[model samples]
Target: MNMLHLPRIGITPDINDLPVPETEYVVRQNYADAISKAGGLPFLLPYHEPVGDYLDVIDGLLVTGGLFDIDPALYRQTSRKDYAMKPARTNFERALIEGALSRAIPVVGICNGMQLLAVCLGGELVQDISTEIDGALEHKPDQSASIAHHRIEISGTSRHLQTSAGEVHEVNSVHHQSVLPSDAYQVLAVSPDGVVEALEKKDGGFAVGVQWHPEYGVADIDTIIFETFLSKAREYSQKK
Candidate 1:
């Protein structure tokens, strides 16, 4: 049996207007498509109160990019800089991640999702790119609105069994805030700047996070990331 592709992804809600009224919750499309292309079943997990119960059944988790920020209060901060673009609560993110790690489930956090993963793992965020970098970056590389924005270099062997070191992957860059002072996760890849572009769990866990969005227009979708994540999910499902 194919034992490395059963994924039940959990997506987060953004600040966009949702199809439902009163309580708002809507998942992104590209994220689900990416998992589907990689041979995994995607579940659009709505922003809810109790997510702990679902952790046991989920094989893998995909934290996606969106137009919101995690409550900075979680990091013990009061300065509200870009509150408009901040993502919703998603308080269940860390719990889900820890749950996955405990059961040996694969995780792939994209963009802000990546940042949250870092924070959950005792890492700090850079907060504002304008303050961190000297010059502005062309976050939107493609004019067509369908291509990945920037480039990233995968420095070491990823959790994905197939990807080799020194591989340069083109990803869509679409955020102003990022994670900095990352210690818990291994610096897997980086962009031109000293800013970390990608990170992997150093504890031999099958998990990775990328600052860029690959679900939109990454040339090789199944190359390493989705492949490794799905493979891990399949493993988790089989053990059940």
Candidate 2:
């Protein structure tokens, strides 16, 4: 396919503080490379209020992970000191996701992005897995992104089973927070330690979130995720 014909995927950027008292919006190169490899054009979206305008231009949305947390209050939870947040980014992403869902745009959330997605969809998060869940595996394992930290059992009823080769797959985990099981969305996968590893929208419009950083491409399942997301984006583009 021509490069111009590739589905345009809007990727949310991480907001970082600069020493000069300003902020910078940045998207990791891995995300762009992964999107390209999956046959989609990655477009980094800045923090802005006009989410509808951004949604109007992109065929799909990829809410990338970041080293931050969503405010507990957003999900009706008490604040904890261990929680680190970037309110600006969270606010923008929340609006962007709401707008995307309203338009039936495909959305793929990664790590922190997944947490925020849960909150946006009337679900809550386990603020800190280590404290909240007994015997929870070390989720934030300090290792290279390419290294597998643990295994997650894919739910047979999940759409992920269509892309995943088997019921269980090794995945790299890097988040301290995990999504709580809720009726608002379908729990797609879970770690042996019982933490939620992946989820999808029940309404079935291609909304999926995985706790692992699939953009790292550590395993075949990672590639399948990007491919499936881009394929959906392609379908959306054609519909438009």
Candidate 3:
């Protein structure tokens, strides 16, 4: 593919302290692999001061899934549960997303990324789905990553997902926090249990967030989402 044809995608990495005394910035290979497979150039981005520097060079942003929860304080809530969160990473992503939005570049947030995006847009989240929503389906599946644990109904009016509202589709689940409906974005899809599974910006600028990990690319809908996002990125790059 010509260099000009492929949009540059900036992907966020998770910070981890696995080995004693050593902090590592890591990102799952699937994110980059999937972006490359979808015809975009993937670049891993780490948390740093002034994220706008990174955003200035990329055509799009991909906020990947992480194991920690964003501090509830950001969305103006308190939680009793003690879950790990990286304040630095959260801060950096917020800046990055803001920069992307200012440029009107396409941005996709997966899993925790979705929560970040929602919270960034004045939305709250159910910190713990099991204890919050009654009769909610199992969201943190113990099964293999390749398996779909639940179904989501996409909205017909959603330009990002491009699926009917009444149409149900199966998807892999791997998160405990979910988005709460807010005026910042239109609820694009939801699980039968009422968990927000997908959201799109109301003004329609190709900004979307999904509760599932579409980087896994396990379903046809995943391909559609990424392709549409990349198309938007391509348009932005051309305009630049």
Residue pair clashes in candidate 3: 156-165
Clashes of each: 6, 0, 1
Query: Where does the lowest 10-residue lDDT sum fall in candidate 2?
Result: 156-165
In angstroms, the error of model 3 at 36 is 0.6
Clashing pairs in 2: none
Candidate with maximal lDDT? 2
Put down candidate 2 lDDT per residue, 44-139, tens digits, no spaces: 998877788899889999999998888999999988776678888999999999888888899999999999889989999998999889998999
Write the residue-wise lDDT of candidate 1 on 107-127 in tens digits: 888888888888777787766
Give per-residue CA lDDT, model 3, range 1-240, as digits (tens).
344678999999998867746888899898998899888999989778788788788989999888899999989999768989988898899888877887788999999999998887789999999999999999998986688888998863786556776877789999988999888899988999999999987774789998998888777789988888888888888887
Error of 3 at 28 (Å): 1.0
Off by over 4 Å in 3: 1-3, 18-21
Residue 152 lDDT in candidate 3: 92
Error of 1 at 13 (Å): 3.2
